[model samples]
Each structure stands twice: as C-alpha cells, then as structure tokens.
Target: MRHRLFEEGKATDCEEKIASLGRTPQEITQSLLNAEESLLNSLYECMRKDFELANGGGVSLPGYGTKGALALMAIYVAYKNGVGPFPKDLLDKLNEGRDSQHLRHIRREKGIRIAKHGRNEYHLEDLRLGKAFSNRHKGVEAATFAEIKAAYGYRCATCGAKEGELHHLPQYRESKEPVILHQGHMNPHEPLEAGNIIPQCQFCNRAYRNWVVFDRNGRVVGVSDWTFVLKSIRERYLRITEENRKIVQELISSLTTQLGQLGEGE
Candidate 1:
C-alpha cells in the first residue's frame, strides 16, 4: 500500500525516508506542524513590516495591514494547532485583540462609524470615504466609472475582462449620498489611506460579502470572483489619471517595504 501510494505520487520520498528513520506518523505530523508554524510566523512578521512602512512607520494591529492577511493567519494558526471548524468566539477574540482602539476613535471623530456586529466584529461605514476625501481635497475630481475603466484599459484586474464593471474598494455603503464609486482607499472616516481600491468584475465584487479573499499561498489577492456582480459599475466610469497612478505607486511601495522589513526581522 505504501509503495502504491508513493507510485501514485500521493506520498513523498521524504515520508518514506522518515519512516525508515523510525519516526512514527504522529512524529512526522508534529514536525510538519512545527515547520508550518515557523513559516506562518515569518509571513506575519513580513506583513507587519509592510504595514508599518505603508502607514509612515508603525501601525497598530487591526488598524494596519490588509484584513485578509490577519484573517488568513488566524485560520492557518487554528488549523496548525488542530483547531477545527473555526468558532465564532475565537475569531472575535482574535479580531478584538488585534484591532487598534486609537484608530477606531479617530474614525468616529471623523464621522465614520465603526459598526460592531459582535465582540470582535466591526465594519466601517463610508468605506471609501478616505480616498474620496483625499482626491477631492487634492483637487482631483470625483472620477466616474468610465474614467476608472479607461485607466486600466477597461480590463478587469482578476479575469482581464474588458466588458466588466468598475468596483469600489472598501465599497461605498448604500446610505451615502450620491454613492461615490470607483478606486479609492477604504474608510475615509479613518486614517491610513489610499490604494485600497481596484477594478474588479461583478462576479468578484459580489463574492466579497464582507470577507476578503486570499490566494492559495496565503497572500491576499483581493475580493473573490465567484459571483460576477461588479459589472454594473463598468458602464459609467472613466479612466484613471496620472494622479491616481501616483497614489497606487505609493501604496504598493509602502506595503512592499513593510513586508520586506518584517521578513528580515523574522
């Protein structure tokens, strides 16, 4: 059976070698778990550094970094520790422990309400208000869907669809007047802004459903593309401008730098 499993490529030669060395299955599993834990810690450190740089040197947890990053890390840790079927209370605890109370306060003062669903659950209304405020304050006109579509050459960031819609990052809530849409940072009512928006298809947009998406290797890619609902925004948007490009560049640089620093520290 072992030979067949190996022949079918289900088992690695390393596993056979470990068996020959007299390591039990439980021991092998433990070793793998340790390795995975080390890897996860390294990744977390890198993410921390990236967030710091992006935020102008240091960001409080739950306030900085992509929400997707934290969520994925929690899931990984739980799985590694033999925790199954993720519990709501544990998730809440993780979120609550990591979030930045200071940042939350600032957001509230700015007219951004942080909606709390449970002990560790929170949502920011006026999701893209930060970007909109910045652009408007910088004299950049509120871009229409057509403008954003033209900027990316009308291609969806995920599937590269030319016929899809423009998506608002940190999407604009329905209650906001005029419902400003397009690429922008999330939670204008809070600090840590810009490069929070991206063009996505309707399917990907709808898949978000208050949850962020992560790639197979555990890095956040963006919202999921399961539903294809973002197409609606494409019909009326315009192209991105040099100003927008600058904002994106800064954001990428900051995140990259922070991640690199964290990796080195780890």
Candidate 2:
C-alpha cells in the first residue's frame, strides 16, 4: 500500500509547486485529489491495524473479509471529497452493496442527534459520519468487552449485574437472520456510533439472545424485533438519573443561554 504512493506523491508534488506560483482550477483539483488520496491511505492503514487486532491475525491484502476496512476507506474518500460529514444520501452511495449498509441506513433513519467536531467544521444532526467516526473506539478489536463494561458503568442493562462480558447487543454474526436481536443501536461495523451499543450481562445477553428486545420503558417487544426496542431504549435512556439530573438540567440551561447571547452565529 505504501508503494502505491510513489507516483501519486510525485504528481501531487508537481501540482503543489504549480499552486504555489498561482492558483488555477486544474491545480486546485489536483491538490484536492492529492489530499483525498493521502487521507484514504492514512485511513486504510488505521483500518488494517484495527482489523488485524480485532481478528487476532494479520489480515491478507485484497480480501473480502475486510469489509470494515473498505467501509472506512469509503468514508475517508467521502470526507476528502467534501461530501461529509456524510448524511444518508452520501452514505448510501458509499455503501451500495456492503452488508454494513443496512446498519448505516438504519442509523441514518432512526438514530438520535449529536454534535460532531471535524478538522475544520462541526455538525449537529441525526445522520452524520463525523460523529460516527468520532465516537469510534480506537484499535482493531470491535468495542472490546472491557470498554463496554466501562461505558455502562460496569453494570448490565438487563437485570443490572455489575459482573459480565460486554455483549454486542444485536449479535454481529446473526445480523442476516430475519429475526435479529436488537440489543442496542450500535452497529458491529461502526463501533463508534455511541447510541447503538450498550452493556448487557452474560445471562441477559445469552438468555434473551434474540428473545428479549425491549423499548425505552423496559417493555418487551417481540423477540428478534429491534425497531420498537430501539425507540423505547432511546427514550428511556435519554433521561438523567435523579442524582445527576439537576446538574444536567443546569448545564442545558447555561448552554442555551450562552448560545442565545452569540448574536448572528446561527
């Protein structure tokens, strides 16, 4: 992969020199292309390392097993091309035939709102790649059992057990089945999408398996059905706990007041 850059770098260096003299549309185009290529290469290397560590082996180049790598590459490309922080339409284009597309689509269609900070911009929206990647856990393995444990404050969502392995809510392996578990909103491929992933105890995760999808109020939607369960969970989880509720409410009020003071920023 590094060797592929010799020619690309030479072309980009030439374009850079030309741009330094004066800016032309052709030079600008070349510069953008160079930036895109550089971004893609960097992103790919990161993805490769992540894939190898997650799978517990060095990944072979040019294989179908690296869908996550490909997805990351596509996202890098879109970002470089100025098509992102990607919304649903651009994500659909990048993920045309990939299995991860379904998860991305679902997130775009039903995910909650969040703010994303990028290199040169920020976005606050329901569907955007900046936030998706921003929330991603660094490294090769999918959200490790340890990270999930920490995120949920070392307790299970079901039954509230403090000791257990972090389970992928909707089991990644079983995503293809007609009746899939909607453990949470987290997509296996996009580990950074915070809303989709959650903590569950070993017993609840295993016992429920595909049988215990739930809504925000802990009402059981039918087994293997994730739609209602996700909706319910989001509503329920969005609430602040009694101990922290006042602080959170005060913060929201303060932020709102500050935003209102910033004249013409909106």
Candidate 3:
C-alpha cells in the first residue's frame, strides 16, 4: 500500500507516519503468497508438464531443463516456507550453478517481477506465463533416427560432432556404443518426420531448439531472429531510464528551489 501510495505521489499526505504494520518479513511474504495461492498452484502444474516434455534436456527456452524450471520451482517453494530465495540455497543446489542469465531473460524480457528481499537476497514476486514450451521428447521414430544419422554422415548436422560416444570414434564399431546424436526438427509445427528433421548434438539441439532450424545440407531453412528481442530489451531500458530521469529531476526540484541547466553557463 505504501509503495503504491509513493508511486502515486500521495505517500506524503498519508496520516500514518510509517507505512508498515510492523509485520515481520516472513509474515509479509506469506501474506503475499496467500493472496495468490491459486495462481501459483496452477503454474506448478504447467511446469510439471513441461518438465515431462523436456525430460533431462532443454526445451523451448535455453537452459530451461537444466536451470530455469528448477530455479523457479525453488523460488516458489521458498515463498511457501516464508523465506527469501537465495541463489546458492535454491539455484545452485538444483543445477550446480547460478543461472543468472535465465533469471535476467525471464525478468527483463518476459516482464516477470523479481523483488529484492533482505540484503542481496531475492524472491519471485509474481508468476506470469512467459512462453509456451513445446517439445515432444522422442517424437522421432527409432528407424528414422538411424536413417537421419546416416544421411548426416553419422555426425552432428549442426556442429559436426561424431554420432558415436566421445573418444570412442573411428573404431567404435568394434564395441557397442551409445550414439550421442539427436534428431532435431527444422520446423516444429510440421509433422515429426515429414522430411523436417536434422541430426544435431545435444548442445546444438538444445541451443537452437526454438530458433535457427537448418536443413540436412547445413542450410538455414527456418529463422527466428534474435535481433528484435535485443532491440525490444534495449527499448525497454531506454524507456525505464527516461522515466527514472524525469522522476529524479522532479525529486531534485522539490528538494531544492534551484533551476538547473543541462550545460552550466558556456
């Protein structure tokens, strides 16, 4: 309430001196969570389905299977426990590393709110459906997998990594080995194997899942430009900075009666 009042320029006129009702931080967090219990519950259900689709690999979003989903779940559960979600306690413990990049993308690009908690800690303030996750695991048939592998010279069509297990190529036929190739779709909306598949490494497949689809001959048949994404983020930053500059100017003017010039006297 106080924050809203401050934003509307009515905080100074409020009769209550301090805005807080003397609630503990935990109490406040619990209150916020309680207010949106139904929404968060539904979000967890969707995440569970996405996890099944991606399985152990990434899908839709980069590093999502390895990082983002688990981190967000941890953040969700942290609020349930009435505590802040620290990176080490939640993020690294699940994925063994900090996925700050994922967090930044979701917050800045997706417009999800992440509020800062006490002293360098943070919390997922609100839950928003950012993007649709589509990934039918093993959507490619086994026989087609072999055919695609052979077509790509038993190597990654994306990065040219050998199809066989690492450090066991050239004579890997002598011993039974697991193939490390993935049949990635060039067009996700098309049929699973309607001549729209390309063999890719796990890294490349995951990296280029939702963008940069290519043909078997290493030609980019499908494109999802990331330039627009960068441009939008840059535009948002500029808008926010301009609004902040105006707010700061107003605050300064209110604090002091001096009229300031952009360039002080030639």
Best by TM-score: 3
Ranking by lDDT: 3, 2, 1
- Point out the worst 10-residue segment of candidate 3 by lDDT: 13-22
The best candidate by lDDT is 3
Q: TM-scores of the models, in the given order?
A: 0.20, 0.25, 0.28
The runs of at least 3 residues in candidate 1 whose Cα sits more than 4 Å from the true structure, single-residue gaps closed, are: 1-142, 164-194, 213-266
How many angstroms is residue 50 displaced in model 2 relative to the true structure, after the best TM-score fit? 13
128-201: candidate 3 lDDT, tens digit per residue: 34343233222233456787687668887666767656523445435454557876777666666836777776
Candidate 3: list runs displaced more than 4 Å.
1-143, 167-179, 225-266
RMSD of each: 20.4, 18.9, 21.6
**Number of the candidate with higher lDDT, 2 or 3:** 3
Question: Given candidate 1, what's the lDDT at residue 260?
Answer: 100
Q: For residues 94-188, what per-residue lDDT tens digits would candidate 1 score against the true structure?
A: 34544334323333333333344445433433222232121212211225556655655655544454452332433532323222223332222
| CA shift of 97, model 1, Å | 33
Backbone clashes under 3 angstroms, per model: 29, 8, 0
lDDT (C-alpha, whole model) for all candidates? 0.39, 0.41, 0.50
